[model samples]
Target: MAKTKKNVNEMSFLDHLEELRWHLIRAVIAVFIAAIAAFIAKGFIFDTLIFGPTKPTFFTYDILCSISQSLGLDDSFCFNEAAFEIQSRTMAGQFSAHMWTAITAGFIIAFPYVLYELWKFISPGLHPNERKHSRGFIIISSILFFLGVLFGYYVICPLSINFLGTYQVSDKVHNDFDLSSYISLIRSSVLACGLIFELPIIIYFLAKVGVITPEFLRKYRKFALIIVLVVSAIITPPDIASQVIVAIPVLILYEVSIFIARFVTKRQNSKALKNV
Candidate 1:
């Protein structure tokens, strides 16, 4: 490790850029390799996972249906099937969607290794203490990302597909969605939620750098709630219940981020006092 550190320290700016280029190349290679696997497993990727939400017997639909039935509410969640047709208009549309979907899946599956490569590139510049403090960064970030992806896939995607699929302006209008549109919805939801779930990590780093404090987070709590609600509304069905369900977790994350900020600030202050 010391020898590796010495090599890093001796590297010129151009050499550093070259090293970064190699890391990026390796990351891209990892993604492409995973994409090949996904492409080979077309049935599982397309039928089992991507199109699961459009089916009536999807897990989220069944659970929500039971809840609605128990509560004697409207049977919005008890639909038979999503009232939409996905078609490829252009000649290469289906092929293009397939390749892109596999690539996106590849990136999602290979995210941890990509993060590792990125961490490797940056860790050489960090102090040993800083590196030690962030030992669990990759693992924790990966877990959060996977959780967010699951939530988006199981909850948000289903809700959006259900609502938008059945929506109709008139009897004359049909909901024939483009194949790319459907894939885009799933991809965006999963990726967006994955990144959003890294809130605590982002806050911790910002606090460590003295950019934000817990007090700032507490002061802006109300604004954060409003923003969460808006985001929830955007991602979920028009129903208040769905919006509340989505907002609850995000609000909890915000509170957790505040706590993380507080912890980082306290640690930094203690270290400063020790140095004095």
Candidate 2:
């Protein structure tokens, strides 16, 4: 079956801007609506999810404890609680953090809708076959994003909290962490991982457009590892184990991206042969 290309509506630059403006407006509305819901559910957002890693009874801690026991290691993982105390020093610190956190959560939750709006703006220019092949773009991207978020929240964030919350240079100096700083760590970690996991999707598109190839990805594999390690080091605590833990998934995603590029190139080659 031959795929038909849709006739793209030609428009002036201002008209294109108008179309883009509408898409942006709709995306913003989606985020706003989701943010309102997040604001309404304050207890769940703050107490349950946000503060989960700070408690000793977090699921990750228990799993670590079990692993340590099974490995005949010391009870280092069997800590009673996180050492740091979170505080809002400024008068508007708590309120500001609450509002921004709600907005960030909204963006995270409405990610798929946001992607859909972006796709709508771009899809008209794509061939019908391209549009058809990319029908699952929003869903696949959303799943990868959420998985990355979970990995950050469960693995990376916990490791960071455990290490930083416990480390002490002196007994006299208390770990009185600012509320904003604490939330920022969580936000950056989750969002960074979410973006990182989109590497395969990014590579797929780049390959499709002939901007990058499987060979390029392969040639730069070692360099990519170095960059990933550097990124992992920046987001995670200054520990080899923490950096390695965060880098592992990212490295896996890179390998998957190489395969995606190869698949896209192979398909493009086959299509070219058919056309010839």
Candidate 3:
């Protein structure tokens, strides 16, 4: 027989902690299984995916080159050859990179499961209506995260690699990047963008909790724009085109977040009035 779930109201603090521990354990196990798979696919993970952006024939490069040609702009984004070499300086550097990369991939692959575990932990505390309303939270969050990861991999990663890899302050300085450094850049970009794309979800929860209001978001619209531009500059290549491309999506997400926040606020007000 399956184990019955304990009622949240009847559970003590220790019981809550124990419940959380089990959820975390399950989530970790899922990640470990996924990571093992990633580790086993070393050739595909390393050669095809990790180092793909460094190659001139990368898909992003081809698309960007075509766009540039069609626009009659200089082929600044297109390159004939890779401009940098990656090397492992430490004796165990390759092994370490492979291990950590696998773990990162595992976490990403198992993100939906992790979210499910998280939702299971918290759902007991929410009202039945709230739980029903948020039935698609895991799916929506997973979709947003995957979209962000793709945007990072296909757009931000290639632009940064093309610019930074090809940049030459002096001919004397050769761009021989370390393996760890290269992997770190790709990992950070992919993960950072993935989290950043959860803006609307974050706003919805904040509004639900009365922590933030839609008017507050609108009042700080100018500040948010400046912050978005700054973040775009930080993430993308230091070029206007790259920055604009990044900023536009983020701006759109922000607007969507505002709409979500407003909807949440209106619903909360309606609930309050009904209760009265």
Candidate 4:
């Protein structure tokens, strides 16, 4: 006869670890498969997406230029051409960048699958009601992540590239960025924003576990604002406009997280009252 699977409560610690290992293995395999697909689409991934912000005709530039012109502002937002040149200084630089970029793209493409794997591992330990309440976790998180990625690519990346690429202290100095450096900027912006946009989901879990409450978030709203600004400054170019643009959505997310925490707390309280 086949061995029966043990319930989560009956499983030994090592068995739990083994279960986790399998989930992680499956997630990694999914990522690798996605990465392979990304590797095969090098032209679209690099020329059309990764290097898109560096072009003068990028969507972000054209929009910003149009807005600036309509508002009667200076031509600072308009770009005739990108001033900096990207070069591979080392023999393996281009190859290494290509490989890493593919991996990053793979992780992004397979994000929902990864979350599904993670949910499968954790759901077994949760009550049926808890699991039911969180049925939309993977979908909601994936949507937020993709939205953040789009925002970073269309707003932050172009702003940073335009500013840094054209800025020169003196006419004698020219900006010649390395291939890895340029890719790194794009990768970091996309991934960081994606993760940052998961703030509401993270807050929901913390509230469910009683680690935080809406009151706590409300109390620290000022500090959160400061932290958001600081984080915006770190991720974006050192300019007020870029920082403000990045900070707006994050601040909105923080407020939404507070509302979520409040809802979770109210549900928990009502459930407790019903059991009394």
Candidate that beats the other on lDDT, 2 or 3, i.e. the better one: 3
lDDT scores for all predictions?
A: 0.91, 0.88, 0.92, 0.91
Ranking by lDDT, best first? 3, 4, 1, 2
User: Compared to the true structure, candidate 4 yields what TM-score?
Assistant: 0.96
lDDT of 3 by residue, 1-276 (tens): 012266778887878888888899999999999999999999999999999998888989999998989988888789678878999999999999999999999999999999999999999899999999999999999999999999999998998899889999999999999999999999999999999999999998998998989899999999999999999999888888889989999999999999999999999899999999
Instruction: Give each model a TM-score.
Output: 0.95, 0.94, 0.96, 0.96
Question: Which consecutive 10 residues in model 3 have the weakest lDDT in total?
Answer: 1-10
Model 1: residues with Cα > 4 Å off, grouped in runs:
1-9
Clash number for every model?
A: 0, 0, 0, 0
- Candidate 4: minimum summed lDDT over ten consecutive residues — where? 1-10
Report how far off residue 37 is in candidate 3 (Å): 0.2
Per-residue lDDT of candidate 1, residues 157-232 (tens digit): 9888988899899999999999999999999999999999999989988998899999999999999999999999
* Model 2 stretches with alpha carbons more than 4 Å out: 1-7, 72-78
Across 88-158, the per-residue lDDT of candidate 2 in tens digits comes to 99999999989999999999999999999999889988999999999999999999999999999998888
| Model 3: pairs clashing at backbone N, Cα or C within 3 Å | none
lDDT of 4 by residue, 1-276 (tens): 011168778888888888888889999999999999999999999999999998887878888898889988787777779898999999999889989999999999999999999998899889999999999999999999999889888987888888888999999999999999999999988998899999999999999999999999999999999999999888777877678889999999999999999999999999999999
What TM-score quantifies how close candidate 2 is to the native fold? 0.94
> When superposed on Cα atoms, how far off is each prediction in RMSD?
2.0, 3.8, 1.7, 1.6
Best by lDDT: 3
